[model samples]
Target: MICIMLVVAVVTTPGTSMASVKMEPLARTAPPPVEFKIQGSFDPSNSYLDQGTATISDNGNQTVKISVITEAKSSVASIGGTVYLQKWTGTQWINVGSASTISASNDWYFSGEVVKPAEQGYYFRARVVHWINHNGVYEQGETTSDSRLVS
Candidate 1:
């Protein structure tokens, strides 16, 4: 036979009302190790990306600038990605403009200004997919910037 116990206590404070509180024992469970979980064929440690960043700023003239910076661990055959300018339409994010570039270097930076005549009062952000091709292996990473209101 198993027994479960519960404790009840009355708590009071100075110049305050008194309330009854119930205390119960907590049940804890250990989580499975990461290696035991089933993952896809992609290995996370094989990525050559060092850092990726995206930014959006108001240009003060009915336009916003979206920028992206992608850095790799070392010089590769090709490095580039696509930058997408997105706008929040009360419920979902929609892409407004996009730019893609490819260069043979370790670091790549790109920026574009989008005219927002129809989306003046919406929130906007920048999303970038930074990729690198090194030793016949292709790896990519994504990053998103903080949202800003287009004025």
Candidate 2:
């Protein structure tokens, strides 16, 4: 004669379930609307100069064209300035090339332009030191253009 025995075991967490559970959705709100106001018009007669403009453009062939225009309130003995081509070197701006021009006689405005070869993958801008000579005294102002990249 022979004898045999059998045994079984089961385990589970105290406060957990084996089935999936759904979560509540989060709430989202939109921001408030914004408003803007306009002020008065500009008056140019109160200033010593009327306008000073500078610009820089890419020529699509590793070159750039820079230009500047300066206007004074009244005609002077002379009006002119130097146009500078500046390059961005990651830290600061440095002059690459420059050209200067003055009116042949008394004039109210002056303009100049220059074309310079630029390096590929670099930035450039135009800077002008505008000046006017009345009688014997000289008044000077400065203007800078928007930067452009050469491809």
lDDT of each residue in 60-86, candidate 2, tens digit only: 788887776778788777777667788
* Candidate number of the best lDDT: 2
Query: What lDDT score goes with residue 133 in model 1?
Result: 80
Where model 1 places Cα greater than 4 Å from the true spot, the runs are 1-44, 102-118
Lowest summed lDDT window (length 10), candidate 1: 25-34
Error of 1 at 125 (Å): 0.4
How much does candidate 1 score in TM-score?
0.59
TM-score of each: 0.59, 0.62
Q: What is the lDDT of residue 1 in candidate 1?
A: 100
Alpha-carbon error at 109 in model 2, in Å? Answer: 1.9
Kindly provide the TM-score of model 2 when superposed on the true structure, using C-alpha atoms: 0.62
